[model samples]
Target: MAALMTQFHVSPSGDDSAPGTEEHPFATLPRAQRAARESVGAVLVHLRAGTHVLTEPWELTAEDSGRDGARVIYQAYGYGTDAAEQVVISGGTEITGWREHEGRWVAEVGALDTRQLSVDGQRAERAGIDGLPDGTTRTETGYRTTSLAPQQWQAPASVEFVYRGIYPWTEARCGVAAVTHTGEHTEITMAQPAFDQAKALYNYEFEYQRLTGPALPTRVENDPSFLTTPGTFALTRSHPDHHVLHYLPRSGEHPSHTRVVAPALETLLRVTAARDISFRGLIFADATWLRPNRSQGFLHYHGSGYYEGGDIYTEVLIEGRQWLTVPTETATIPACLTLEHTAGITFEGCRFTRLGGTALGATAGVGLTVRGCDFDTLAASAITLTGDRDAVLEDNLIQHIGLDYAGSPGISLLGTAGCTVAHNQVTDVPHCGIVAGPGTGTVLSNNHTDRTMGVLADGGGLYIAGPQGDSFDNGALVRGNVIDNTRTPYNFGLYTDYGAAWVQVQDNVVGQADNSAVLHVGPPLDHVVFRGNYWNSDPVGSDAVPAGVTYENNTTLTDTDELEAASSAIRARAGLLRTQEPAIG
Candidate 1:
């Protein structure tokens, strides 16, 4: 099924007065979308050559058909040509009410499409911009947006003291800048006050009647990792009468001191409800923070498929330095995008890199499929899933993950059912390549891992942590996986935690190991079997002759200490009474 044809074109010198035809096209995308929605079958909206500045999003609506086989499609005509570059709809800049002053346009800083600085109605001097050798201009500089003004330096009589400078955990403390709370509604804005002649002034709310001592009970110092100061403030403010006291921070200081803050998970969920929305071709540098100071999942949709196509290059250089010195903070910073609580969602042909947090984070989805994606240089885990059902993760390349955190895994699966992790390449991560945790009817098959740059922490090709709940029937299968040079700081090629029963480990390959043993099995349940796996740790080849579970035709190359250890772990897990239990319990 298709909607009626709605021809809409955009040009730099066009207006709405023009008819929505190929010759005389509608100038605005909203007009085109509106006209297309009113059509009967389908509307093919075409955008002509030029740039179109948009203040809001343009959403297209499809008409509903009576039968199942009917569908509506809105096709773009000039998507493949430089002439196809005819339409450019942009937002995030505010320019209005500006007259030509000194041969320049004057505009307010309402929104910014480009980073050019402007004065009262006209473009003014710009920072970090210089003329280049080829007569091109470049913006090679950035501003420190986190700095505070100079007047807020002195400490006030009463202040919401946050000392996260250094040694934050031991020195956390909070207090009311004054004895009173004042603001419109629940807001409190305080001014400079006298507290031992400290110039720091605060504006805040104190909901409670009074307290005998300081607002919070902790102290402060100068160190990194500031998890405890806010923890103490929130602890003291748990009472109903306790309220937030606002404090205008000193110059170059933020109002709040949290290491990571991200857009609220709900905002992402709202964006996920649309169809054919793609992030692949856009340069997203300065999007506003829709939500701040919370940790939540990214996106969620109901039976709607999500699409993302894009690339991210870390503007900050991390050659031989710490990565977190940049003031930018996001709690669950997704590289490309995230999809949660969805059905029939698909991710294809995307690139995720230089991420602040996870590359792809998913949870509680059904009929999900991810294909032909590349993940690299992620600060956290590359791909993570939780509580998913009937998902397929296939044909992707994942590498260089956990660059910021040494304990992070490449892929973590928690309570996912009837899913498959297949045909992917994983390397240079800090933890396990694939971890299946307490899930039923899951499969890890035909995946390859390069152990040359193996993770320093525990876990390798596949890690199984089970028995978290009774819902796990141990119907998990691990087969046809390849591991090479996987040097872990702690444990195995395949690790099994508690309640690992009726699981199958077969048809896999392993190359090297570190201090820990390979094929770790612990706190067994019923029939955790290992069979038909190959090993090549020593000069003589050996078969995978695991002792504990029922062995099936498996072989190895050059029996070594690792092979013997694997055999012993199988025996111990098989209840054969070990000489000594493996360290992993």
Candidate 2:
């Protein structure tokens, strides 16, 4: 006979040698998982109210999957009760032992390789350039500056230069190779030039011109001289095996009283090829991620260069000249929660906060759902779902994401089919809000996005693209979304670019966009239908609304009262679920 359903318990004060019962719980999730692996049928692991520090990933592989209509659930102990408590699963190490040094606080963290630090549950700033450089002149190779002394630029080779070009939308980070002085100018050569200068198109607009050229105005960071501001920190290695943190504490904040932490692990949970697993009511926090520096290149395909009506197509070129643009690099950055080749996995009512990389990621999964979760203060993208089938991301609140990396979106869906992205509020992101591409049967509805593309350019609140030949016969539906406050120079509220076809966009309210309210660009803009959309601002310079587009029932609001009413109604219907409530029955 098969074993009966099993229940395992984990707590911070429990012992691993216990029987994993309500009274005697295991100490860690991995120990409970080990006990669950030895059992059969259904298994549920209850995590009590406490902090669980993860020194390594809590991996759930295929062998640990539930069988025969059973599921493996990891949830809070009192999940549905009023007494439900907070369960924190952290991937960082708390630091103690502070001393004063020259009006600053210093701590010895001992070989922790991280760039992110948190104090009292707030993300502290990394030391960066205080202001703009003194002077920047374009060079044949890279750029020359008269900003700092030669010794001030002699940071380690790992230091990078973040440059904001002539356009607000154009930015790049390149590694420094050597910093030397030529006459009166300090010449800095990059390991790899941000972009090829020879391939730049000179006669294009300023926005397009920066995309094809070399670096513009630049600011170098991570130098020791910039570590003067309060709540800013720098990590220095004085010995081969020891690392120290130099911190400028804020007023009334001291190391002895503050809960200071630095990220130690890259991933908190790794579900690999598992099935019938669910994680709910848990907090995942404080994981580090380093962006890999590889041979990255961009390709700018000028439509005027090819044909008469071809628009400028700028994409991250990977290998060939086939006009294929890859999504933001995912294989290099680590995430807090990674689900790879997993099926029947769900994350409900969970919290992912203060993470250094992407918060949640799923690759090649089926029957995946991320519902009623909160993703905040993330360094990279909030959520990325790729090559998944029948995926649903709904009723989630994502804010303050993409704080460090500007290339990623708040939510990105690539090669995902039959997916529903609805009722989610995504705000205060640096790049796009909801980016769905190269997919079919995707329904994006009732999602509110605000203040997106705030720091970067050339994106939108709702951005969609596809391959050249796919017909989108499944008919992607983008309806009832509220896109507001897209303030970047070239960012649109709703953008369909590069062969997006056979999609219906309806009933969305777009307000206060820098670019057009709805923009259609690139080639093969076939069978895109826009209906019943309310534009709160004038769409003045949009010319890519092709002749065959099915544009009908769209309205432009001139009255303030009507625009405010429409915007308020849309927000009320598409608002975020900040607290736990009953799921839609």
Q: Which stretches of candidate 2 lie over 4 Å from their true place?
A: 1-4, 130-132, 136-150, 153-158, 165-170, 177-213, 237-240, 292-333, 467-473, 538-545, 566-571, 577-585
lDDT of 1 at 306: 11
For 1-585, candidate 2 gives per-residue lDDT tens digits of 875779999999999999999999999988999998898789999999988999998889998898888998999988878888799999999888888888777787787777688999899987877334657766666668776663474344445556553234444455555677777778766554333322232122332332334445355555555777888877664454587777788889976688889988888899999999988899999898644222132221210011111133445332233222222222323467899999899899999998887898888899999999999998878888888889999999999987666666889888888889999998998878998887878899999899998777777899887641245468688888988888777777888776787788888888777654544455656787788888876554334466646777787786657876856766566656553354587
Prediction-by-prediction clash tally:
48, 1
RMSD of 1: 17.5
C-alpha lDDT score of every prediction, in listed order: 0.43, 0.74
Q: Model 1, range 1-585, lDDT digits (tens) per residue? A: 543443455454656777777677676766665665565543345555443444443332222111132222322345434433423333323323443333222223221212121122122211111111122111111011111311122222223332121110011123222222123111112222211111111111223222121122122211111112221111111223332211111223222331111111111111232332222211111112211111111111100111111221222223333121111221233433456565555555545544445666676767667666677755556777778888887767778765433445677777788888877777766566777777788887877766622534445566776643333254778777766566644546655554565578776766565422243343444456667776654211123534435655666655566664655433222211112355775
Tally clashing residue pairs in candidate 1: 48
Candidate 1 local accuracy as lDDT?
0.43
Identify the candidate with maximal TM-score: 2
Worst 10 residues of 2 by lDDT: 300-309
What TM-score number comes out for model 2?
A: 0.86
Candidate 1 runs further than 4 Å off: 1-336, 452-456, 467-474, 515-522, 537-548, 558-585
